[model samples]
Structures are given as structure tokens and as C-alpha cells.
Target: MMDQPATSRTIDTQCVVAGSGPGGLMLGLLLARAGVDVTVVEKHADFLRDFRGDTVHPSTLDIIDQLGLLEELLKVPHTQAPRLHAEIGGRDVTIADFSRLPTKCRFIAFMPQWDFLDFLAREARKLPNFHIVMSAEVTDLIEDGGRIAGLVARTPDGSVEIRAPLVVGADGRNSVVRAKAGLEVESFGAPSDVLWMKLSHQPDDPPYTMGHGGPRQGFVMVDRGDYWQCGYVVRKGSFAEVKEKGIEAFREAVAAVSPLPADRVGEIRSWDEVHLLSIRIDRLKSWWRPGLLCIGDAAHAMSPIGGFGVNLAIQDAVAAANILSVPLREDRLADRYLAAVEKRRAFPTKATQKLQLMMQSSSKKRQESATKRSGPPSFVRGIARWPFLAHLTGRLVGLGIRSEKVNMAALKAR
Candidate 1:
């Protein structure tokens, strides 16, 4: 156990951030850079796995560049998934073209989330004020007079009581800290379950591409060189059923919808290679309670649509860091920090959720229509023939759908 520094001890202000994922690590790094003694705790001991949410959006890349970690991140093996090719309203459109964006870091980079988390951890370690404890799980939060005071965590050796003025919950969707704080979250829509798997790629495999079959239907993103991230849509909680169907049936399903070559899909076998990601979004009415605040998935979990979960989590981390970088003793600093984070992220969260619902509903409709009709829908044919309507419909469903100006307005209102 490390003793509190003199500076931190003088004010009795210690910040404990739970979960050493990207959001928690970045939050710890930012706070430490601002001269705040921060400790980041994680349940996992190492970043070694294939997880979902690998695509880093351009907006998040901008923030990474702002933090001076862009150069280091680029050095890591990553695939630039710049074009979002989506089959919306039965017409294919590409949004988020790297050429159109003004920033030098305009492309969406596709790398494992673990790699991104590792990069953040490495950068955070450079700051002496930042400390990280792996293999330590936060089991309970310590409350003082209805405000968060610290946390009770179980390390490998034993349980330890760590004190802090502000406790941050960056611990993901199933956060123990949020539960301990007694925060109520409002969930939306039925759960969207995904059967995610990675296939080995030969050197001669075709170049990486993103292919979206329809709404509700899962898509594929080529990561690094030969490995392709593929997802299949299933009911809210039907992973076991899908798994029972076997890998061969799953490959046939992928071949039916995706643009990927049949040979690649054939390589996948066993449930071990396939990951099941059950997606749900919840928004807490209030992300702050006295001395505690929640960020990242702990604060709001959004749909995987647009791969905005990680980006949004990092965005919340950045916003929280900006607001809390000031002295905690400052009057209502915690209150202002919560308000700022909620304000900055609410619109983005809403926008992404709306998109997710739209895609889910549309995909269901398309599947139903496919079952009823022998051929493509008339509306799809109309759009395909009329290029003008195709572009217009694309803009409506795919391009510039979220207004940054409106989102910024919501942030300013807070």
C-alpha cells in the first residue's frame, strides 16, 4: 500500500478511478498530469484478448492527438477503417471519408480495444502521480455523509480500504461502484446480441473492407492484415442457441449476407474463437452524487452502432478530466464536474442511441420483407435507379445525421 503524498494529504483529496480500461486510464492520466494523485484499479491483470469496439472514430483520434499520444498509437499495428459502407434504406453509402474530414487524423483506426487500453496504460505510467493496481477488484464503495469517500477493493493479498475525496466509476456497464452509489439507470430497447468471431487471413487475402448487410444485421471490419472481425445478429439473449447451431451454419449465414469471400468464413471453428457481446444501453438520470462521479460505460452505455462506445467513453473521460482538473476544494467542484460531463456527453449519447434504434428497426423490417417477397423492395429499386434520391436518402440516413452544433448546444446549456 502506498501512502498518500503530502500535497494530497494536506487537502484530504484522493481520487480513486475503478477499471483500468481506456476511459479509466485516460482519466487517471489526465488527473495525474494536473497534479492530482490518482489511483486506477482494474480486475484484469493484463491486456491480452480479442474484444469488440475496435474501431477508433476520427473524433476520438483528434483527442488522442491532443493528448500527444497519437504518434505512439500510430506506431502500434492498426488498420485504418476510414469508410463506413452501410446499406441503408436498401442503398449502399459511404460516410466518414477520410478525405472529407479536415483533421490530419481523419481516419477511423481499427485495432483491438485491449491494444488501445494498453497504450493508455503505458502513457499513464509515465506520470508519477498516477498509480495502477491490476488484479485488484473494487467490491464496495465507502460513503461518508451521503457522499463518496473511498472504496473497498480486494487485492491479491487481501482487502484494502483506500480513501479518496472523489470516486470515479469507469468500470464498464456492470459497474460495482455505480451500484454501491445507488444510481438508477434507465435502459432502452431490447438487448442486441452479437455473435462476434475472428477469422485467420492468408497473406493473399483481399484488402480490408467494412461491409454492412442491413440494419440489425451485424457487419464485418478487417483489422490489422488478415484477421477480420465479424458479427452476427441474434435475439436479445440467444447466444447458447446460436452456438448450438454450430460454426458451419454460422459460416453459411455470414456468406449469405456479407461481402466477404466464402473461403474466409469457412476458417472459423469452435465457440472459443467466437465472442458473444450482449449489447445494452443505459443512462443514469444523474451521474454524480456528492463526492462521486461516473464516467464511460459506468455513466452511459450506448449501442455498438458506429463503434462509438469506446470513443464516447474516452470523450467522457476527457470531459471529466477537464472539469475535475481544478482543485477539489474549490466550491462545488464535484458538482460542476458531473454537470459538465453529463452536459458534454448527453447529446452524443442520444444521437448514437437514436441511430441504433433506427438501424435495429430498419433491419428487422428488411428481414421480414425479405421473407415475404421474392425480390428487392420497390423503394430500394426506386432509389437505386434515381441517383438524386439515392444521395438524398443516404444523407438522411447515413451522412451528417448527427448535428455537432446541436450537440454542442446541449453541452453549453449545462
Candidate 2:
């Protein structure tokens, strides 16, 4: 009988990316497009989870445009927010105007994160070398001679060990890959957490996507076609207290901060409908080890103030892929190369975190003075009145401090 080719049970690739979030998925897609065999391991069965980062900033859309996927991706359901408004005290102030941004897509695209991930996955699969292993969770590092050779992941069949020269940890803030690699993070505790709830959309609600804050209560409402996705900002570690107070009290508090129709606030009738995200402003002091690299929230956790998390993650992926793709493909990547990724991204990460901390402090002060009744503060009016300040604020919220560009040459198929 002719010798039969043995069925290979082990999955091998040039790179094993942990977490299928924006950063991980982008890096995987970019690397695969460059003809590198890459595999992404996702802990979840699918990207259908709720309350993920849904704001796709202009910078990220530019990346999609660069890759020629923007038009197709936009076909998915989404809304464009060209301006950000905040009803402070009782005055309506424009906080950010994306119309002033230079990018082709000047507005923030609000789409469910799952749709974004699905778009990337679908695009990546068009390339023959890309692979995604869903429902596979990374459990430990596969060490060989004191280097992070690869990782051990628990999958459906059993424990599966993947060995590769490079293991990218895009897992997230609480990252198993980062933990296994022993990366230390410096946390600047957040003053507030967010309670995510939705209210039914009404025709009478203000047309502008806006934030509303009155004394201690702050919430943001974004138009999602038929509904209002509301974020109720509360003091850090207050979920238990909020819950103990019962759903009606929480509903009234949120209702007070919403710019939407107050009657619709009753839509949030149960605590079950609300999701709590304990905000933390943190970053890894160092973003890499000998054979492992962390990006996105795995390297730096952003506060939800500006909806910058998804954009930052996408930028990190671009920078990392630009720096590491060639070295990884040629089988000559080194720790210094990983160091360069950190060096390139550290400034923006620090700058964003610093701003988030400032916002948190300011919010805490506002909450303490909740009893005061007044009009919008001078700064709020100044931001709306001064064109320069408004433009600067818009750029900061839209493009970030230093936006990253994905090198087309690096991503070109070989």
C-alpha cells in the first residue's frame, strides 16, 4: 500500500496572537496579508459580547481605508457622530467637533464591536495563511531554554500547545499572556466606573450625540439608530451601593444625566440590563519580554472618557505589525525590535492616561459639589466659544496625540 500522509494534529504558524480584539485581529490580518502564516486564539466562541468598545475613531477608519476595506466595512450598520455635545449645568456646549478632523472619515463610527471584528476576520480569511481558533483560551507560556517559545492553550479537544518564535499578547487589561510573561503594570486608579444601559430612542430627543452632567451625576448618550446607548458614570467601586439602592433609584439617577427623553429612561427597568465596567487607567511599564509582545489594552488600559480605547488598540497593532512583520517573516526578530514597538507607542499611551486621570479628578470634584446649582462652567463655555480650543479638543479626541499609520509595503502580499 502507498504510504499515507499523516494527519497533523498540531497547529503551527509564524505568529500566535492571543486575543481576537481589534489589536490582535488587526495584527493577525496585516501579518497574514504580508504572507506570514499567523494564527489568532480567541477565548470566546464569537465576538458577540455586549458593551465592548464600539467607537471606531477616524484614525482607525483611516487604517481601514488604507487597507481598502472602509467602504465595504461601512456597509455594516453604523452611525456617524460628527460632533460631541455636552449639556453642562443647563447650557449645551460642544465638546468635540469631528468635522474639523483631517481624516477622510472625520466622524466617529459607532458600530457594534462584533461587527468590526467580524469584518476584520472576514477580510483576513480571504488570505490563505490566516487562521483563527475560537473557544481556545491561553493558559500558560511554552518556555524553551529561558525564552518564551510559545503558549499552551485549552481548547475543546484538550490542552493544545502552540510553539512559535513570536507570541503576541493582545489579550486585554487582565491578560493571561502578559501574566504568563510576567509583565508588570503601573495602575493609576480611576475615580469612576461606568454603568452601561440603553434607553429607547424617541423622535423628540435632541439630534446631537451628547453627554449630560448635573452635579454628581454624569452620563453620555449616543444615537444608535433606534435606541440610545447610555453610559452612566458613577464613582469607582460604587456598583454594590448602586445595586443595593435598587433599580428605581439607579434609573432616576441616570435619568437625571441623560439628554434623551426622560420618560424612556424607564426602559432600564432592571439591574440585569446594565453592565458595569470598572474603569482603570493603567499601562505596562515595559510592553514586551524576550519572545513575547503585548499590545492594546494588554499593554495599556485606557479610561472610557473619550472612547479612545479601540482606536489606541488599532494603532498599537499597526505599529507592532509595521515593526515586527518583516523580522518575524524572515525569522530574525529580537527583543530590541519588541522594545522599539514600546518606544514608539509609550508617549501616546502616557499622554492619554494622564488626560484620563485629570478628567477623573475633575469628575470627583464635580460629584462632591453636586448640591450646587449653576450654569455651565466657564471652561465649558470657553471651549464652545473659542475656535482654537474647540479645534484642539476635537483633534485630541478624534486623532489622539500621535496616530499610527500601517505601512502598506509591509502589508503587501509577497
Q: Best-fitting candidate, measured by TM-score?
A: 2
**lDDT tens per residue, model 1, 129-156:** 7787777788888878877888887766
Best by lDDT: 2
Among all windows of 10 consecutive residues in model 1, the one with the lowest summed lDDT is 403-412
Cα-based lDDT for every prediction: 0.68, 0.83
lDDT of 2 by residue, 39-84 (tens): 8888888899888888889999999999999999999999888878
- TM-score for all models, in order of appearance: 0.83, 0.94
- Model 1, runs deviating above 4 Å: 1-13, 86-95, 214-216, 329-332, 373-414
**lDDT score at residue 140, model 1, on the 0-100 scale:** 87
TM-score of 1: 0.83
The residue pairs that clash in candidate 2, if any, are none
Cα error, candidate 1, residue 398 (Å): 13
Query: In angstroms, how far off is 78's CA in candidate 2?
Result: 0.5
Q: Residue 83 of model 2: what lDDT? A: 78
